[model samples]
Target: MQIDLLRRKIGLNFNDGFAEVWLWAPNANKVNICIQKTEHRLDMLAKEYGYWYLKTEQIRPFDAYSFELESNTDADNAKLKRADPASIYQHDGIFGDSTAFDLGRFEWTDQNWKPIAVKDYIIYEIHTGTFTPEGDFESVINKLDYLLELGITAIEIMPVSQFSGNRNWGYDGVFPFAVQNTYGGPQQLQKLVNACHNKGLAVILDVVYNHVGPEGNYFNDFGAYFTEKYNTPWGNAINFDDAYCDGVRTFFIENALMWFRDFHIDALRLDAVHAIKDFSPKHILAELKQHVDKLATENNRPYHLMVELDLNDNRYINSQQQGGYGMDAQWIDEFHHTLRVAAGQEKTGYYADFNGIEDLAKAYNDAYVYNGQYSEHRKKKFGVETENPGEQFIVFSQNHDHVGNRMLGERTSTLVSFEMLKVMAGAVLCAPYLPLIFMGEEWAETNPFQFFISHSDEELVEAVRKGRKAEFSAFHIEGEAPDPQDEATFNRSKLDWNKAATGMHKTMLAYYKTLIRLRKENAAFNDLNRKNTQARAITDKNTLFLTRSSEEQIIICLLNFSKNQQNLQLNLPGNMSILLNSATTEFGGPQPTANAIQHNGEISIAPESILIFSN
Candidate 1:
C-alpha cells in the first residue's frame, strides 16, 4: 500500500529539557517516531481516538524528523513522512523532509520600527515582478529609498506566496506556507522586510485567503481543508466552519503569524475577503483579527490587518467593541469611481454607474456611494453607512487590479487629461481616507498594467482568456481581453524607469512629491476626525470646495472638474496662502503668469485642476 504518510495534525510543545509531539493518524494502530539529532526512537502511546503522543528529552533547531505509520492488519503497510506543515526551506517540494528552522536565526536591525497607523497611512502598491526589471524581493529593497523619498509610509506588495511556476501576480498561490522560489524564497522576504524597516517604511503584505490555486494544492491529501458546500468565483471555498475547520483555520492563522513573526511584516492586507464564506459563530476574519491583536499585544509591536472587500459593509472596518469584526481599514472603490467620473473621464464598465458631481461629493462626505442606499450597478440596496472616522478607508485613483483588468490595461494617465490627472491625485491624497498610489503613478509611467499570468496548463489558459472576454462583453468594452498567458502582455507591463526623468513623468512625479510633502507637513491634512473635514459643492456645478481644519491650521481644497477654465466667485473667512497648485506649468499644465496668489477673501479657479490654500 503506497500510503501518503502526510501528517495532518502535528503539534510540538517544547520546554528547556524536553518536548511533547502529538499527531493524528486514523488508519495507524502502531507508529514509530524518530528524532534526527538524538537518534531517539519511540513507540507512540495512544492518547485518544486515532491519536498518538511522544514525550522525549530532545530539542534542536533544523532537526530533520519523520513518522512511520502502520495499520492493525499488517506491519508491512506502514509509511514514514515529515511532520511540520510550514517547513521554511523545502528542498524537493511538498513531499520533502521537514527541516526545523529557528525563527531567531535572522538578526533583525529594526528594533525601533513601529507600524504606521492605518489612519496616517499613505500606501504605495507594487508588484515585485514588474516593480523593477530585476523582479525580486532584493530589488524591492533597493527601491525603498525611492519610496521613502516620495513620502510613502507603507509599501503594500502584491502576494509573494509560492505558486506553481516562477512568474505570476501571486493571486494564484498554491503553497500558502511557502514563499515563491522565484522571488528568492522566505529568507529573501525577511531581508526585504528588514531593509524596509531600516528605512522607516512599513511593509504590508497582500494575502489571498479566498481560494488556493489549482496546481500544487495538496491540502486535500492531508485532510478536508476545503468545502464543497460553499463556492467562490475561483472554486471551492475553504472549510472555515466545517468538521476539520479548526486545523484549517490554524493553518491560515499560522501562515499569517509566519509572515508577521518570522518575516517581521508590519501588516497584512487580506485580498478579496468578501469571498471568505463562513457561516459559523466565529467568522474566520474575526478570529484572525483576535489572534493578530493578541500577537501584537504580546510582541509590543504595532500590527495591522487591512482588508480588500467589495461588500461595502461598514462592519468590516468597525471596531470590535461595537460588535464588529475589527479590521484596521478597507479599500474604498467608490472613492476611485466618484473621482474618476467627476473628472469626466469615464472608461467602460463600472463607470456607467457613476458620472456626476453628487457621487463624488457623497464619496467624499460618506466615503461610500451605497451607504445603505439603492445601487444601480448591483441593482439592489447595498453598503452600510460608516459611523467610524474616514481614515479607516483607503482611497486610490488607480491600482494594479483596476488598470490590469482593462482590455488593453490602460492606466488613468492614458484615459484622463494631464490636468485632470493632477486633480484626481490631489483629491485622493488630500482626502480624509488613507491614500494608495499605484507603482508608477507618482511619475505617471506610460507602460500599461496589462493582466498577465503563467499557467502551466494549456486548457486553463484558454478558459482564463475566455472568462476575461465574457466578463467585459457584458460592459461592452471594445476588443477581446488580452491573453494573460501571452508573454508579451507581461513584458509590456514593465515600468520604464527612465521615463521618470522625462516630460510628463517628471512633471507628475514633482506634483506628487510636492503634494505629499505638503500633506505630511500640514496639520490640516493630518487630521483624521471627520468633524474637522467639511466638503461643500460650489453650487450645483461640477466643482468641489473642501475645508480641513485642525488645532494648528486651516486648509481649503478647490477642485474644478470642467474642461475649460471658468471664473468663479469664492467665499473665504480670512487671508489664504497658496500652499500647493496641481495646475502649475511645472506639472504638465498650461503656463500661467500667476502661480501663488495671496487672497483676502476670493480666488480664481483653474479648469480641470486642484488648488490648496492654507492660513
Candidate 2:
C-alpha cells in the first residue's frame, strides 16, 4: 500500500463534495492552498515523511489556485506563492495558476480496448504543437482518422508537458504533471487519447526526465530537487542520488504512473536517457518500469517504456527478472545513420564513423552497428554485444532528432532524391524492428521540424539562440540557423496538411500506405527472431537483400541504393513473387518493361529502387 500510495496518490483528489490535496514539500516550514479569485487560504497539515495534506469542500474542480510557501531558504523567511509542481491542470498556462480537476467527471468508452504488442507498433510520431494549424489536442482529434488511414497502429505524440509560454518542443517542461494549457489543457488531452483508443490506435507520450526548463521551475524553493554534483548539457542534474532523494524519486515515478492510470496512455518514450545521470542501485528507470508494470497488471492492459538512448545497452530491453531495466524497446540511431550515409548523406560529426553498407548490414543482422567496435566519432569503443533481435530496437530512417537537430532542419524528403526515398522506406519497414514514421513523413510533408520554444523570459531566449549557434559550428549545415524564438520559425515548422494529398505527395502517401499494409498483413515482416532472418548486403552491387521466413513463406526485400542499375542473382528454395515493387508506375517509377520480381536465377533492379518478394 505504501508503494501504491506512492504511485496512485498525490496532487488533487476529489471525492463526493470535497477535494483533498496532497503535496511533497520537505524544505517548506508551512504551505497554504490559495484560491486565485477570492484569495481563500487553507492551511495544510504536515504528516510523516515530509507529506502535507488538506481536505476542503471549498476546493472543487476547475478552481484556480497556487501554493503559498514559507521556507527557510527565503531572504526573511517570507511567504511566496508558486504553482504546484504536481499540478494536474493549469488555468492559463505554465506561467499561471494550477487548477483542480476531477478525472471521474470525464466520460470514456475505451474500457474494452486491447492494444497490440510492442513488436507490432508502427508508430507515427507527432509534435502536437506543429501537427496542425490550431496546434491543440482537440484539433489533433480531428485528424486521427487520417492517421488510421495511413496504416499506423500507434501514435507517438511529442511531449505535451507544461513548459513556459505557448509553444515549445516540450523537452523544456517544468510542470511534469500539468498538461500544456496552450494545447487545451488536461480535459482536451483526455478526449484525444480516448478517441485514439476508440479508433484502435495506441497512444505513446514522449516524456523528458533528464532536465527541466529554466523558467517556471519552483522545485528548488520547495526541496532538494537538483544536484550540482554532476553536469549535463542542461547544466545541473536532477536530484536522484542526493539528499532528500526519496521524495524526488517518488515524485517522478508517480508522474509516470499517473499518465497510465488517469489518461489511459499505452506507452511512454523516455527522451535522451543518455543524459540521465543516476548511480543508485535501483535506478530511477528501473523504478519507473516496476511501477508501470504493476499498473499495467492492475489495469489489465499493455504498457511499454521505450528509451531514447545512444548507449546501445540491452539491459534497457531485457526483462526485469534478467536484471535489466525491463524497457520494451529503445530507439536506435545506427540504422538511420547507416542508411543515410549509404544513401549519399554527408559524413559530418558522428556520421563520420558509419561505414555505409557495412554498418547497414550490421544494423539489419544485429541490433547495433558498433557493438564492441571502435567508434571513431567518440574516439573509443562503444556498446556491448547483444543477441537480441530487431524487436528490441525501434529503427527509423527519419525522426525528430535527425531532422530537427539539423542546422537547416531538412528531412529525408529534402536531403535525398525521390527514388532513394522509396529505397530507404522499404529498408526501414522490411527490417526486423519496430518501425516509426514521423508526422507528415508518410505523404512527405515539406515542412522542416525546427527547434522552437516560446519562452517569455528574454535572458533564457538569448541563451538558447547563442547555444544553438555554438552547437551549429560542429555540423556541416548551410544557411543561417533559424532563430528558435521567432514566431515564423514555429509557424514554418507546422505541417501543410493540404499539400499532403497533391501531386507526388499523394503518390508517396499511397506508397507508404501500401508498405505499412505489407508489414501488418504479412507475419514474415515482423517475425524478429534473428535465427530465422538473414540480412546480406551485396557491397559490390550496392544492394541489400533481406529475407525473413516463418517455415511457411519467405519474405524477401531487394533494395538497390546505387545510382546505376544493378543485376543480381537469387539462389532461393521457393518460387518468389512480388509483394511490393517500388519500380512500378504507381509509385512514380520509370515504367520499366521487365517485371520487378523474378522467380529464380538473375533479376534486374532499377537504380535507387526497392522490391519486396514473398514465396
Candidate 3:
C-alpha cells in the first residue's frame, strides 16, 4: 500500500468558524477531537493511509484542542487524551492541549525582501533565551540595529521550537512545529522573521531532526515514530526507513517547509545531520531538498538548507544529480577544531587528533583536516577526501558547542589572551568560507554558556547530571560539572550588552567591526573561490601565510600564532602595502612596525597578531 505523505495537511487548520483537523495514528481504532474551551468532543473519520481527520465549523482560531486515541487491543477500549503531535502552538505546556493558530493572519512587510547570498554571509548565531535579558523575540527586535552595526549579514537563531521546559540548549525540543510559548509563541516568531527580512538580514533557524527529547515524548503512544534498528546518542533513532516511516518523514519535512513558506525564514540550519540514520533509496535529506527546491521555484526566491554535520563527507552538500543530499552549506567542525588546536587549546579528547599548525593549514586548503586519515580520537580511519567549494563550508572560531560543552563553559575570551583573540577572529574572517560569530563574541563577553535544562522529571534530571559528568571524565577537568537543572546556570549564561561599550571590550568590538568590514568591502577577501586561495603554515616560527586573490586584486594575510614577534618574507610578485594590521595602536595593540610597503617582500609581525598586505 502506497501512502501519500503530503495528501492532507496535518494539525488543526482553523478559519473564522471552519476548522480541519488531521492526525496520523495507524494503531488507533478510533480518534476524537476534544475542544478544551467549550468541552465539546467530535468523532473523526478514519481515512486511508492511517489518518484520522475531521472537518467542522465548530472550532475557531486560537481554540485549544487534544486528540483522543482509542486502541483496538485495549480490553476496556479506553481512549487516551494526548496533545497533538503536530501542534502549532502549545500555550499551556508541552504535555497540554494544542492551540490552533491562524498563521495567515500576521501582516508581513517583507514582500520585497531579498535574501543574502550564502558565500557572502557573515552569520551572528544567537541563543534567544540568553541573547537578551527579557529572553523573548520582541526583546531581540530591540537589538536589530546593534547587530546591523556589528556588520553581520544573517542572524542564525538557536532552536526556538517548544522544548521540555522554559530553559534548554534547545536540542531537547520535542514539538517541532510549536514555537516556545515562554518565548512569546508562534506570532512573535513570525514578527521576528518579518522584521529580519525587512532589515535585509536573513534569518537562519536551527532545527533538530535527530532523536526527539525524552520528556513529554508521547510519539510511541500515537504511532511508529522511532525504530530500534538504529540508535543515536540521545536514544532510539527516529524512524526514517522502517514500516510507516513515510508519515514520520513527512511530518518533519512539512515542518521545514512551514518555516520558509509561512514564517518567511530565509534559511534553516539543520542540526547534526550525521545522527539522522536513514537507509532508504532516496534519503530523507534528499527528499527534503526535492520538496524545498520545488517551493523555492514557486516562491521565486532562494531558500537554503545548511546542515551541522561532523562527517567530512561532502555528499551532504553535493548536488542531487551527483547522488548527494543537496544541502546548500554545512558547518565544518574540522575548521573549528584545527583552528582551536592551533590557537593553543589543550590537546585532549577530540583535540588529541589535531596537531595544531599543520592541521589548521590543511583545514584552510581542504575543508576537512582528517580526510581519509586515521583519527586517534575515534580509533579509526575517518572522513573521505572530497573537493568541496569554500562557500559550501561555514567556519567559526567559537560556537555554542565549543564553549558550552566544557566543564566550566568558558568562552574563547576567557581561555586565550586578547591578542590571540584577534588572531582567532582574523583566521575565520579571512578564510574563503562563510564566517559565524557566537553571541557576545564580538565584545568578548566572559559569561559562561554552561548547559542548562528544565526537565520536569527528577529522575531524568539526575540521569542528565550523571551523564554530563561521565562525558567529561575523559577530559580530566577537575570539580563537578555545573548543575544543568539549576536556574543559576541559565542566568549565568546571559550576555552582558553593556560590556560591548566599555574599555577593552569596546576596543575588541571595534576590531571585530573592522574585520567584518574588510571581509565585506575588500575585493580579494569577499571572493569565496578556493582556487584563488593559498594557505601555507611555517611550523618553526608558528606562522601562517594565506593569499587570497580576485581577478583584479590580491591580498596576502600573515598570522602569527606564537607569543614572540617574528620577521617573515613572502616571495610574491609585486610590492605589498599594509591593508590592515591587528597589532596597530588603533586596535588596542602596540605598534611594533611602521606602516609601509614591503618593497622586498619582508616585514616583522607582532606576537599573536594578523597583518594583511595587498598588492
The models' CA-based lDDT, in order, is 0.77, 0.86, 0.89
List where candidate 1 sits over 4 angstroms from the true fold.
Answer: 1-101, 593-602
* Candidate that beats the other on TM-score, 1 or 2, i.e. the better one: 2
Candidate 2, TM-score vs. the true structure?
0.97
Alpha-carbon TM-score of each model against the true structure:
0.88, 0.97, 0.97
Question: Native-vs-model 2 lDDT?
Answer: 0.86
Tens digit per residue, CA lDDT, model 2, 1-615 = 045722356777787777888888988889999997778999999987788889899987888998898988777999989888889887678778888888777798888788878778899999998999999998999998998988988999999899888878899999999898889888888999999999999999999999988888888888888999889998889989888888888888888888888888999999988888889998889888988888888877878888999888888788879888888889999899999998999788878888787779888888888888788888899888888776778989898888998877888899888889988888898888899998888888788999998888899899899888888777756567899999999999999999877999999999999999989888788687877778788999889888887767788888899998887888655577777779778898885542664445778889999988888
Q: Between which residue pairs do clashes occur in model 2? A: none
Query: How would you encode candidate 3's per-residue C-alpha lDDT over 183-272 as one tens digit per residue?
Result: 999999999988888888999999999978889999988889999999899989999999999888888888888888888898999999
Better of 1 and 2 by lDDT: 2
Candidate 1 global CA lDDT score: 0.77
